[model samples]
Target: MSDKPVAVIGAGLAGLSAALTLQEAGREVVIYDGSDRVGGRVATDYIDGFTLDRGFQLINAKYPELLRLGVVDELDFIFAPRTIDVCVGEKRIALGDPRSNPFASLNPAAGTLIQKLGLVAYLLRTADAAKSVEEELSHLGKLYSRVLKPFLSGVFLTSPASVNAVIGKGLITSFISGKPGLPRKGVGALPAALAARIRKIELNHRIDSLSQFENQEVIVATDLTTAAQLLDIANVPKLAGSTTWYYEVPQELTGSARLLIDGEHRGPVVNSIVLSNLISTYAPDGKSLLASTTLDFASESEVRRHLALMWGAHTGGWSLIAKYDIPKSLPIFAIGNQSAASSQFSNNIYVAGDYRTAPSQNGALLSGRLAAQELLLDQGR
Candidate 1:
C-alpha cells in the first residue's frame, strides 16, 4: 500500500465501495462528500416518524457486488412479490404466472399470449443487442403501451424507448432471477452499512478540483454531472430524471407487496408500492405508507385522484408526507456506453459512478471496485 492516503470523493455507494475495497487491501483511504450524510441518491428522510427515501429505490438481493461484499446479510431486507399489479382502465390486473391468477392472465389488456411470448423472446434475443429498448419493444405491438411502457419507465427513470435494450433486459432478468427488496430501515441503510466498514470519512467536504488534494490519489465516484465538473471532462452523457411522492394512508390500499403499475397511463404516476405492506417499519403503528414514482412532478391531489381511479376506491384521505424531485437521477447509457474497462480517466485519477457501467446499484458498486482494482494493479499490488 502507498504511504499517502487514497482520497475518494463523494461518499455514495461507488465511492464507499472503492474506499472499502482499497482499505481491505491495506491502503489508507479517506472519503469526502459534500453532503452531511452519505449514500448520494440513495438517501432517506425522516418526517413525522415516516421514512421517505429520496426516490423509490430497491436492492436486488442477488446483486453480485453486494453479495461479494457480504453486506446483504448485515441489513434486514423486505422482499417484494414476484408478481406485479397493472392498473388497466380501473381494473388492477396481475402480471405473473397464469396458474397463480388466471383472471389477470386472461384479461385482454394483459396482451395476447402471442404478444407476451414475442416480448419474452425479443428480450432474451436482444439481451446483448446494441439497440434501444424503444426500437426493440416497438416491434412487439400493443404490449408496449399496455405493460412494458408504464412499468419500465418507472424502473429506468425514462421512457423505455430511449433506454438501451440490453440494459433493460439485464434489469428485467435481475428482477426475475433475484429477490428485490428494501432495507428494514430504508434504502439508505445499504450505503450507511458500507460506510461503517471504513474509517476517516470527512462529511460536508466537497472537492472542486483534483489539484486540491496534491500527492493523494483521487477517485471520483459522484453522479455523472458532478464527476464531469470535478474532473473538467466534457461529453458526459445526459441523465434521466424522476420524481417520487410518499403518502401516508390510514388503511392499507394494496394488501400485497407487489408493485402496482399504471397500465392505462391515465396520469403521471407510473408505478407505486404500499411501502408498509413490504415493511412495517416504514410507517407508524396503525398507519400505512404508499409511495408512487412519476417521470414528472405532480401534485398530491393529482396522484390521489389517479390512485382512486386505479384502485376503484377513494383516496381522498391519503396525506402526502414527502415528495422528491430528482432531475438527474440516472445516467442515460446509450448502446455503446456500457464499458467497465474505461473507468480510469487519467493517471492517478479514476472515475467510478453508475454512468461508467450500468445504471444500477450493482453497476455502481462494481464500477467502484473495478476502479480500485485498476489502482491496485497500477500500484503493483
Candidate 2:
C-alpha cells in the first residue's frame, strides 16, 4: 500500500465508517466532502432552540451495525414508547409493541383480535419472507390500511407494496429487537460521534474525479448518484423522496411518545409525531415540536390541514420552523443486493453506501466497513 493516507471521498456515514475502520486497523485516512459538515443526509438543524432534523429519522437501537459498534451506548438515546397511535376520525386507536407486549393489544380500542393474531404471524416470518412487502401483508385486509400502510409509507417514504420484503423484514426485525429513538443532541450526533475519532476531514472539498486520488488508496463512499457519476457507471437506481415540515407548537398540545400515523388515508401526510414529547431537549422550554412527513409535493397549508386532521388538534397557531424537501432521500436497489460484494471495483477503487447494500444506516456502515476491510485484505495488511 502507498505511504499516503487512504483517501475517502465523502464525509457521510459510509465514508466515516470506512475511515474509522481503516484507522482502527492502523491505516491512516483523509476524508473529503462537498458539504461544510461531516454528515451528508444525516444532519440536525438548530433553529430558535429547536432541533429539526433534515427528515423524520430515528436510530434503530438494534441495527446490527450499531450494536456491533456499541453506538447506542455512545449516545444519549431517548426512546419513544413501543406503541403506535392510528388516527381515525377524531380519535386515535392505540396498538402496543407486539414483540414486548403481545397481550397489550387486547384492549378493544387498540385493534381487532384477528389483527393482533395476523401481526404475530407476520413477525414470526419477518426474517425469512421471500415475497414483496405488499404480497406478504395482503392477507390482512384492514390491517395494512388501518395501521401498517401509513406507518410503512413513512418508513419507506413510498408505498409498502412497492418495496422488497427483505428491507421490510430487516426493519421489522430491528424494531422487534430494540426500540428506535432519537439522540439527545439530535440524529446528527450519530455521525458526529463517528467523526470525532477521525484524524483529518476536508470539508467543502468536492472530488469530481477519482484521478485526483491516484497517489493514494481510494474508497468511493458517496451516495448512489455521485458514486455512479464518479465511477462512470451507466445504471443507477431511482431515489425515493419526502418533504418534512417542522412546527413549534404550544406545550398544551396533548401528545404521547408513540408515533402517529394516519389511518383514514385521506391526505398527503403519511405520518406525524410530537418530537418534544419523546425528548424535551428537542424544543424550547414551555414549547413543543411537531414533525410531519409527506411523500408527495404538499404545500405548507396543505400539510397543516393534514396535520390538524391527523393530530385532532388546531394547527393554525403552530409556527413553522422549517421545511425540508429532499428529492433524493433514498435509493432503490435490487432485492438481494444487501449481501453483495463491496470489494469488486477495478482500478484500485472500492465502493460503499446504502445503494450498495440495503437502504438503511446498517447497510451504509456495513458496506463501508466491508469495503475498507477488503481493501486492507487485498493489500495483505
RMSD of 2: 2.0
Clashing pairs in 1: 134-161
Q: After best superposition, candidate 2 residue 148: deviation in angstroms?
A: 1.1
N/CA/C clash count, model 2: 0
For model 2 the TM-score comes to: 0.94
TM-scores, one per candidate: 0.94, 0.94
Predicted structure with the largest lDDT when compared to the true one:
1
Give residue 326's lDDT in candidate 2 (0 to 100): 93
For candidate 1, write residues 1-381 as lDDT tens digits: 347899999899999999999998888899999999989999888888888899998899899998899998888887777789888776777887555666665666778878877876875674545778777777666677878888888888988777777777887777667778989989999999999999889998978888877666888998888887888878777899988888887664657778888777888888888888889889888889989888877777788888787767788777888888899999877764465666677878888988877889998998899999898888787
Model 1, CA-based lDDT:
0.83
In the range 1-381, model 2's lDDT, one tens digit per residue, is 789889998998889999999999999999999999988898999989999889989888788888877777888998878888887788777776656666656754445689768877987864433556777776776677788778877877788766778877676566667778989989999999989889999999989998877867899999889999999999887788999988887777775877888888878998888899999999999889988889988888888888888877788899999999998887754343345654658756888998777777887888899999999998888
Q: What lDDT score belongs to each candidate, Candidate 1 first?
A: 0.83, 0.83
Off by over 4 Å in 1: 97-107, 128-130
Q: Name the runs in model 2 displaced over 4 angstroms.
A: 98-104, 107-111, 126-130, 334-339
Model 2 C-alpha lDDT versus the unseen true structure: 0.83
